[model samples]
Target chain A: MNATQSLRQDVPEQGGRRPGGHGAAAPRPRPGADRDSAYWWEAVGEGRFLVQYCADCRTPRFPAREVCAVCLSLEWEWREGTGTGTVDGWTVTRRTFHPAFEAPYTVLRVALDDGPALYCWGCLVGADPDGLRRGRPVEAVFTDVGPDPADGGPTGGGAFTRVVDWRLRE
Target chain B: MAGTGLSGAAALAGVGATPLSRDSGVSTTALACRAILAALDDAGLGVGDVDGIATHRVGDSSPPWVVGPALGITDPAWHLDQFGGGGVSHAVIGQAALAVAAGVADVVVCYRAINARSEFRMGGQGRAPAGAFDLQYQAPYGLLAPVQHYAVPARAHMQAYGTTHEHLGAIAVRQRAHAAANPRALKRDPITLDDYLASPWISEPFRLLDCCLETDGACALVATSAERARDLRRPPVDIAAAAWAGGHSTYSPPAPGGLGDDLTTSSAARLAPRLYAMAGLGPDDVDVAELYDCFTWTVVVQLEDYGFCRKGEGGPFAASEALGIGGELPVNTHGGFLSEGYVHGINHVAEAVGQLRGDAGPRQVDGAEVALSTGQPGHILAGTSALLLTAGR
Candidate 1:
């Protein structure tokens, strides 16, 4: 699952088609940002996945936490992820409530070996929808989801300008 | 139940509901007031007689204070405003029962009113407030809405227990049959297993038929001392026990391994024993079940959690006729949130009250002496709650 050999082959090229669009145009809804989670988002923007690791207990928490559940230790560090994980479970949303999230996209619950089993959004590029199975290996991929370059320059219609998504490991 | 102090202490004296619909064409406030008034009337009480109130809301419903004023009760001796979807279903009523039992307040009315379908559908792209850890981690991945959130566990349950969509479909079909007899049900058309299987998938493991209705309506119940209820207009359903508790700490900065141990189980596992202990009963004593059916998978999970069946056996249990109206337990006799409507879980309480009083016309469980009603499966922050209603003492 290491992308070093592939020279970051898992990462999408700067200007490619963003996911969840069915040739329809809609602004994506961004994650609600606040002081606690801004650092996590910033790391994602830089193409690095970070999990809050408790210094005292050696436990890693996701969604960012102030105090460790196991140790109640306030001391923690943002550990860089290996960008590799296993699919604990997944769902292909055939219909959705958000217009920006086009239907028929698979959402995988990835159990990061080093982190929590969240990372709710998933990606399985070039794989059949039926191919999705628990325990399948996957690696993280970052995509710049901005105005399509072909739309005569930034119409500025999308959620996060860039997001850290995932893809199945070859 | 030696310590079942509240047993026969309070009773559900009245149950009332507005018409279930996709659109009520009225403000949630108006709907809440109307339901409250109707319940008061059913209880043979008026605005002046009401001394306490309680309600649960999901942002789409009006709060107790607003509804109290509209119903001509400006000042109440006891009142509670709870949050969360199905978790508060019976917890609010339990709180009210405690109030009445402790002599803090009497003549308490518990209600839940929502215009969910018409205004701010729960499935829509409504982001949680900032700093909510689960939303921050999940929203970026487009894991919005309860359907998607719930599907993850349903998938895990299937993978581990080999639970199939057919197992879940049977629940939908059976509940729809119950709804067919309920005139107030929004979707009363009887559906077959094939119809359930044929429904399009909203989220995998959850087809369109597996989801609860996006309902616009309100349901309310009146609670007072069993002594007071004897003189009321209707027969009383004694509040044998009402219990609520947290579980597994799944989504709250979840434990290291994610969702802790088993995904198929819920907080009900921890709650069922306590609830029955308070009522001095067990699963076998329950004549009817009104388990929350926010999604069919939830019902399946809860059946196992509450000791109706062994853990991995929920799929097969759901597939059997054991949950039908004439079957052993007769779950969700009013069709549940799946087919009847989603007034949170208050409707489940209403149905239990009806069955216990022998007021449920076609769907009533014969000689139902004990009914078990559940709130949402306890996983999310809302956790879980339940009540055991028995025929009056």
Candidate 2:
């Protein structure tokens, strides 16, 4: 298996659900999905990254909002991301804020190549931290996270939950 | 230039705080009462004279209603219990000044009482509260701490301007030197740039020394009309200007049709002109600056945004002797949040009052008359606030 595949396997895919359900590891913290972002999270679960585009102005936004900040348009539609971006900035977290994340992980702020300066943040896997710099090209990689038993997961149930991270472009 | 009609109409008569430390061994209520009482005493005013109280918190500290009754204020004419963090620190004081100037209240005390260290540590692990729309995007990736959130922009500034680690270390070293003369500062042991370089990284580009102390304390300020302030025991520091602005934050991407976020700049850029214009003063008139130093990069970016230096020059500006007590423009005369305890930027206001009052002693800038104090530069949280104060009414 490649490094990316191995790293993906390391994550608690079934939300810590084990075979026979005898010893389940603790579930990682799930995103607090609400009405505005439920659909986007649903798409993310299906291994598709979506960006919200205002119906009127055609302006794209991330971390979905109810109204278009530019045109005040309440109407919007989802456009799938190109799964490609450029690193605008990044940080190497030496301190652990969560048990699921270990020390020395690099978090990146990447500007989407498909959208108008829309930036998203995610963990940088399958890459060395030393090569990180502004404008470095990257591609999105999605990992499945099963329905969290604690809160039925972001999609509420029966959906393939996933999270997006990044890897340097080959 | 006439300001928003609130300029110079109200003045800060007194400033007080509990000794800042990692642990205060008291409830936030007790801390609030003590600080408020101390400020009232400093102003030579009693609880009977107070008709308004204002405070800001983030589900961690006492509110105005609880603190008001604790200080024997049963029915205040006006009170504001704002909900926020360092971003709204100056806004609370500004709201108090508005109450006093508009005659909605005779005497108003603005306070912030937080047990940040002993209780709700900012960088500590916790679930993101409901309605934090932005955290839904960041928290999943373990981007939970302010240090982590701030590191993104700090690195962006470095990449854009060639700002180096030495440039950031200079700020830590200078603030520590200033803290040496401040008896109230928490970390007073002098730290060299070498020491700062050797400090462990909490978030990359942010060494342990780059972050402010998570402190347990409360700070209070008394505001009254300029007429009432002139008769107070301490010199009246006129509230020359107060400005607050909100825009795209690191957590939220810049709007597609709006002004693109300049990662190198901060909300302070939008606030500086408004603040100076309201005060009818220019940046050159500022004798001492108590700019927010939540992290070393904040001070650097603010220096550029507040017109102390040109864009991309903040790193060089902070690295020079210009930030010293006798330099061209002394900054963080009370050691700032970096060395002085962090009451979440409220202490920066108190220190600004001290410098303008000529009561800062060894850290006091010579013949200082004007002071500029600010809240968080709006790296993480979008809201940012600032205040400009003059020595006398």
lDDT per model, in order? Answer: 0.79, 0.82
Number of backbone collisions per candidate: 2, 0
Please list the residue runs of candidate 1 whose C-alpha ends up more than 4 Å from where it truly belongs after superposition.
A1-24, A115-123, A147-160, B1-8, B125-132, B247-261
lDDT of 2 by residue, B170-233 (tens): 9999999999999999999999999999999999899999998889999999999989899989
For candidate 1, what is the DockQ-based docking class?
acceptable
lDDT of 2 by residue, A1-170 (tens): 43234444564432332211111233344666777888887887777888889999898887688898778989999988888999988899887676656666778888888776687877777656886888999987765555555555343433435667787886
Docking band of candidate 2: medium
Off by over 4 Å in 2: A1-26, A152-160, B1-4, B126-131, B251-260
Name the lDDT value of residue A164 in candidate 2: 71
Candidate 1 positional error at A106, Å: 0.9
